[model samples]
Target chain A: MSEHHEKPEISPAARRFIIALCVLAAVLVALEFIIHRHAYFTTEGQPLFFAVYGFIAFIVVVAGGVGLRKLVMRDIDYYDQGERDE
Target chain B: MSSLVTLLQIPGLLLVFGAAVVPFLPHKLRQAYMLAIIALSAYWCWGIDVGTHLSTNLAGLDLTLVRAEAITRPFALVFHIAAALNVIYAMHEKSRLTATSGLAYAGAAIAALFAGDFITLFIYWELTAFTSVFLILVSGTPRSFAAAMRYLLMQVSSGVILLAGAVLLWHGGQGLSIQAMQANTLAGGLVLLAFGIKAAFPFLNGWLQDAYPEASVTGTVMLSAFTTKLAIYMLALCFAGTEILIYIGAVMTLFPVFFAVIENDLRRVLAFSLNNQLGFMVVGVGIGTELALNGTVAHAFAHIIYKALLFMSMGAVLYRTGTAKASELGGLWKKMPLTMIFCIIGAVSISSFPLFSGFVTKSLTIGSVAKDGYFVIWMILIFASAGVLEHSGIKIPYFAFFGHDRKFEVKEAPLNMLIAMGIAAGLCIVIGVAPHLLYGLLPYDVKYDVWEAGHVLGEMQLLIFAILAFVFLMVRGWYPPEIDSTVLNTDWFLRRALPRTVNALSRPFLAAWASAVAQSKTAILAVLHTGEETSRKSGLVSGVASTGAAAAIFLAIFALLLLLRFVA
Candidate 1:
């Protein structure tokens, strides 16, 4: 069905990035287990937390905006030819 | 305003009657008539009293035209908005019956929220069921007809259960004063069960997925707002703190995500996600604290916008492209940029992105659960939230808007369609950006700040991480994308597997019955033919033999009866 569409190739850099993410996730999970085992994390007020929150929010908004513009869009009638009830 | 509340009582019916006349009118007048009904209904909504009684009965049932209280206000406000917006969205459709039904459905739902008595609620409650069915029928497809029947049956059954409960409560001399449901009694259970059916509680969930997808694009938009939310509203008001709802809510949240993951129809996926979101409000209602109740009400308020926005986006797609199957769709964002943007906002909001509408409203429920120290429920809720992101967040957008861009061309959504979405999308953001606008309307004061550093960071971390997981799975081809195929969940018990099983189990029985019917017909025909042949061949002989036998039997019976009577 997608004969005219070329399959995009995956890059090594993207693969490396994914591997790094996996490693970071593992470290985070390990940290969570350790902290829970010792019960080290507490809901205490911290300025650094707020800063990080704001920063991440900024990053996400920008990233999501760009991604929507670049990757996620379509013509209104793009799939008009597909199955539809008259 | 108290006097004005009475207008809400009957205006919906009046508007419906007025809308019924639209078809006979000139083409230009149809939209005007529909718009007038909506305008009048909105005017009536503004006049209805909140937190006060409008009418009461000798049986001590307090019938209020409006309860501007924190709990009911959000529902009424959102419903009014949705009704008006649906009118706008549906303006271009030629079906006058649909407009009339929409008016009646919205009016009934709006009145139901204001009902201080079970009787009044029951009246409007059934109105919602009866009138809303027109929407599906207006679709004019065989599938929609069947779906509408199922939807009507389910909704009518809910009304029956609710009415039965009301009757029991009234007769038992309790004097119906709408309050929380009790666990030990038949009446309370029936009422709770009624709400459960409408609320799409785990097992009773199939009707929504079955029906909503089959509705007209605009019909589904209206469908998204009222029925389930009203159930939640009832649950919040009447069954608050029923501990079972906590577990039920947990299950409701977690289970649908998996089905949503593999589901092909974007609308059905949204329907599942809707069920998941309702679970949060259910949990809050079960918690039954001021904060929790506030959470439930607030969540309902926020959810209406975002969910409608989501539906609006998909509806636009379906309206223009005519199919909502994820696999069959790709890359229409170029033509429908506004729709894409709006849908993404809806997605982020549903995913509870920090600073989005869902973030503020949903956290209250999550926070309340955490505060209550129900660690397991909270954990399940978080899991469900992640699952929500997976199905609705990545799946809906990735397939419908972005995926492979199948290179088909269609015009952007109609101007009215864009306007409808634009309004709903704006609300999603506005409510998120300034939650106090919504939070202030909560039944109880919520002291917790949604934008607090901890809450914001925690939610951001969770949602962002979930998105990362989705992207990772997708990029690695680990994400399941069985688009254009249904991935049944508990609905399987009804929609496919149960129906299939029933059909399978009945095949032999039906065949046997059919064969028996055929055999009986043959035997009767054979007997008739034989009798005709006998009459033709031996009519005199047969009559003489019959007469002789009849005379002999009459003589024997007469002799026995006469002997018995004489002996007595």
Candidate 2:
């Protein structure tokens, strides 16, 4: 089933968007050193504080969410079965 | 002053009852009439004087029906505007019930906002719940009907708790005023719980995620605009500065990020995102400072528009394609470029990207929390902002429009829907660019600069890094693939566990009761048979002799009585 459908190619416009986004992220990271931040706490003043925090947080949330699936994920008909019996 | 008082407009009445006349109008006239009602209501709300008016003494308590303050004005305005847009979007829906109920729902929310006393607020609050359920049921799916039932139970429970809280408050000598009160007391705690339920706070949040996605395409868009925002208005009005709300808000912000990640339904993902957005406003209300409250109002204003836009795009997708599940959709952007663009705008606005509506409004809450030295909470909020970017900002558009192409060919959204989305999308950008337009409506004076270099840079770093993280995950196959499935949440307890538990607990009891009823029925029938037999045995003799014998006995007695009376 997976082999039957050809993998869709990324369009030129989408490719440009991805490239531009990568470049923009790199530029923004460099600006963290040049820009003066009015940091609220001592740790936030560190270089790349937001970048590091945001990246780690995103991974943690995603990984945590996947783990949660182990606990809460059920067959799509989980509720539907109950409704039928009801 | 007397003449001015008499001239005061009750937009709530106009919206609520005026919608009842919609079915009487011809088909073409209905749309014009609906739009006219909304416009007139908007005009009425805008012209409302900045004071409590329409006070009446009822049952020895003063009830103020219209309280137009700066804090509530923005919420009411956005609700009216969103409702009008909803009317436009649904102009082609052909269901008078949807149109009428939608109008009444909006009217109830607006009325609840302007309510000066708990009694008035509770009336409109329950009205919203009662009327909005029709929108959900209008979807006409069995699942939607079930979801609507659950939604109504939850909502009406909130209203009942609110009424109980009001009664308690009145007994506590607080009078039925709708003002900030300490949550330490029983009454205050009950009221807070009520608002918490409607606000979709944590465990109480299941109804929103369960029902919003189950509503009709346009119904979801309408549902997105009201119920929860009304609770936010109430929170800002009464529960500000309450320490518990800050923690609650923070948790509200964080938990949905996880559920939204692997959720299959795109609309459900937006529902989760809506919960996250509400978290921001809750924090602002918790802070209760001028700036924080202002942030709450501005964020609510911005959220109503952009969230509606996001829901509209998904609705259009669902309208065109038969499903909104991410697993079933991809590469629709080529066919529905306009919807794609509108969805991306909504995504960016919600992501707090620079020059988007979220960037300006959400910062105020974050800034206030940081200033107040809630270092840990501020960090959590910042983290949740990134989480928002992942689920709502990237995941939604990626799977729905740009991921592995399923090669679906569908026309763009209908013209009225595009018009509605365009208007909402336009507002998102406008608010993002000229936030002062929103800021001016705040209850407090504006002093915070949203365009400061530090704030903007920090925001950009957080958002951009989050985007990179998404890219890395997608490229490395670390991202969870969307599957056709439902992820259980707190609603599982009510929808499945509670019913099964009840069934388990009641089966034996019900059997015993049924047996007992059968036994009792047999005993009663036996007794009735015995009585009938006794009566039958005596019936012939009594029937034959009764009339003539009774008359003779009566005459003899009467003669004896007459003789006795003469002797006396």
Candidate 3:
């Protein structure tokens, strides 16, 4: 069996945005190797510390929200008992 | 200077009492009058210096009405600026109630800043609540009314709790003067609880997200400036360096990030974002170092301008499009390009991109946490920084202006709103570029180097990579989609659980009361029926004899009594 990855259709502008993002991320990672960051802790001193954390943290926050929605989400008029205005 | 001390009335009285004339003035006159009053109030407030205070005897306790702290200058300055911006942003507003209440609300908050005693502070605290509640009420919807009531309940509860703590302080031989105290003390704990509620600390944060976004288009902007920041000012004054605040602030910083992600309402997302921003200040207060305190003050000042700018842009969008939900708004960049630019500026400023306000100010606090060797908390703060970028920096702009093109046929935001956003954006940039301007007003001298290359590189890497992750998620369809829904928060305890609990608890009592009432009615009717059967006419009245018969009986009784008395 072969695993298939779904690549959603996108506009050209969005595709360009993704490419520009990749370029920027690469530049930042390259700059990290050149610059000496003032790290207060051992983990912070690790190479590409901020870049790794930033990328992972953003993913985690969004993923956690996806899980949270299942538990907490309700209709817009949840509290008003359907007294929402037009 | 001594003679001038006699001339110093309370700083914000001009706006508070002067609001009386607001209702009577015409539109242009009202706007001009409000601006003039704010200018005059700011001028009067400027003359006040620490130790140059006026006191009066109230019920044998001396009350200071015009005391100033070193931190008071910056808070007062930003507050006046916010007030003036409100007047400008509301230039198109014709509702006299919003005008009067807005001015009075701003005035009360400024007054609270200068209060020297708990009693005086409590007065201004409740005044801010009473005046600003109208902003929520002005939305004129059932939800807004409910929100206003809940907002008032929390505000008034804070005031009452503050007073209770003050009385306990006085009872404990501590003067009623507002000063630092041990959080372990009963009075100190009570006071901290009160401040925590207004600061939107953890479970006490419900009212902020609940009420703010529900306010009218411009009203939400006015509502944002005063209340929580006032609580933060008090927290810095009273509870700075408390160890508990460190953990509490950390919790505050992280939880809102997740909630903001899936929230459909853009304004409410900002509210959650505001809560997240506040966590930084709280953490700064917890650190209680010179650098950290300066960071808190500087962050509050910059946060005020940028937050207001962000809210104003959204308000402009709401005003024209008649919706602020992320799911509803899209492709507004062409329609309100100026608003989009202003929103982006606010986003970058909040995201702490280099050369923005957050970079200079938020660094001092995070730097303090790191320097203090709290590695875990520091990491949490860093992660929270990325989370801030996700919601405020990218999501707000992406969904509202760039994502799904709803093709809203809306015009540009009003001229006055543009001017307000322009001025606020200009301030954010000025403070960001030359942080020394804001630093000079801080309580302590700043030693933190915000622009160090090493720090700058780290910050840029953090922010840029965060954006990359956002783009990555979007392209892959891994990001959570905004849907119209109610996201349960701590407010669920107040809005849902509390009411449901009350109804559940009262059910038995209500049922028993109903049964008792029915039994009483039956017993009364039975007595009446028994009397009616005997008399045939009706109850007790029918048992009475005719007039002549009654007179004869009375005479017989009187004669018998007379004979008995003679025999005795």
Candidate 4:
């Protein structure tokens, strides 16, 4: 399946748009320092706490999911192989 | 709203009995009848006054069939609306069993919400499990049939545990009341466990992921709305502020995001995301503050709409393309642009984008968590919110619509599906923009504002950064590709490990039992033979004794005794 279709390459324009969006997001994170952020915890008062937290949390979740897939993923027929339909 | 109907006219019954009449109707009228039932029920939900409606004695206990309170009213409202929308969405479906059972399941869920006593709640609770199983089974595939069995068992087990808890509560002199309980007693803990199972708390959650995706497309949409939300309503009613729920809710919020990320099945991803969304409501229920409870109810209301929207879109995709696995789906936006748009709306709503329904509702819970000063939980919840963005926000839309082009052109979703999704998507936006439409329906007085600058900025930062992370991973090819594989969860115990263990355990046990039966059979035969021989010998002896020989012997002995006496 992978060999049948070439992976679609990101258009340069789309790439530029993505980069711009990332920069805009970075600017928002930077603006958080000046914004009067209501920090629930004292530690959360730091600049870009949510940005860093969101980034790391997503990575952790994705990484954790990858690890879990390695442990638990099986052939699609894993549960369906038997005729236990009584 | 209150002047239109008397208390005795329970809205839920209109749905329940109306569903009974569905199978009798001609195929053309079935859809219309279902729609009418939902409409009438919705009208009743709005009209019924906020008080106990019907009280009756059953088996020496009082059961209340309809009780409307501030909390129950909102849940009932959303349930009816969701049912109605689901009916409309499923209008094209011709399956009588699916239509009938779906309506019945919806009605049972509504009735369970209105139930003022544990007995009534229990009746409706188990009814939901029984009726909804038909929806799964009506798919008529062996996989769905098997999934339905597991789904039914898990659901019924929850109901049974609920009954046991109710009985214990009654024995403890609680008198069958359905109300908040302390977890110090056996009844309270059992009741919590029961609700937890339906609510898909952590390890007990596998059933939702296992069975829901396997349901028929329309059935999945109907299912996505009710069962768990019903349990959430029950939890809000019965186990508010139980403390342990706080931790459970936190864990519930976090774990599903991970599973959802790598999930190949789009519907299963939605299932995991559903679990994650329920976590927010659970946290609110755990907080048990008036604000938190209101948040929970309002969130459930919003979630039903948005989640159904998501499921309906995916259902459309599955209906058209014949597969919901992400591995087999991509670049569908070219043909199914309407569905893509709706899916994006759902994704945005669930992601808590600033102008979406989830923003208005989920923020309340996060705010309450922060206000209550549980810093760690508050942090975990924030993280989970971002995780929500990863799996539901990006993964759902990107893989299905915008990811690598699968070069498949399919027709747009059917008109009924688009209309249903349109209405749901409309509600998501309406509630997001004008939140008071939802806030006013909350169980408590509404004071919190969702558009506070700090909250808006913080949520935006979190969501945007999460998106950035996703883009980073995608561009770098670090993101996991969707595969045609099954990811294991707690269901492994019942579906895989337990079956194998049973097979392994039963073999030796069967052999030993066979040997034991053989030994017992030999011993029993020997005993029977001995008895037969002894009986034959005894029969001959008795036959001789009964005859003249015995009489002569007796006479001789008597004569001897008489002679001896005479001599003496």
| Predicted candidate 2 versus true structure: per-residue lDDT over B1-568, tens digit per residue | 7644342366566788787898778778998998898888888888886898777888898898887877877887899999899998998798888888998899888888889999988898899999899989998988899999999999999999999999999997989989989898999988999999999999999999999999999999999999999999999989889888999999999999999988999999999999999999999999888889998999999999999999999999999999999999999999999999999999999999988999999999998998899998999899999989988899889888988789987899999999999999999999999988898888898899888887799899888888878776765557777777779998888988898899999999999999999999999999998777645735532454665777888999999999999999
DockQ of 4: 0.49
lDDT (10s digit) by residue, model 1, range B382-436: 7677777777776787788877677868988888888888898888889888888
* lDDT (C-alpha, whole model) for all candidates: 0.75, 0.89, 0.91, 0.87
For all the predictions, what are the DockQ values?
0.06, 0.45, 0.53, 0.49
Candidate with best DockQ: 3
Give the native contact fraction of candidate 1: 0.00
Docking quality (DockQ) of candidate 1 = 0.06
- By lDDT: ranked, best first: 3, 2, 4, 1
Collision pairs in model 2: none
Higher-DockQ candidate of 2 and 3: 3
- Predicted chain B of candidate 1, TM-score versus the true chain B: 0.87
Give the Å error, residue B436, model 4: 1.1
Ranking of predictions according to DockQ: 3, 4, 2, 1
lDDT of 3 by residue, B201-300 (tens): 9999999999999999989999989999999999999988998898999989999999999999999999999999999999988988888888899999
For candidate 4, list the clashing residue pairs, or say none.
none
* Comparison by lDDT, 3 against 4, better one: 3
Query: What does candidate 4's lDDT look like per residue over B284-341, in tens digits?
Result: 9999998899889989999999999999999999999998989988889999999999
> How much is the lDDT of residue B181 in candidate 3?
86
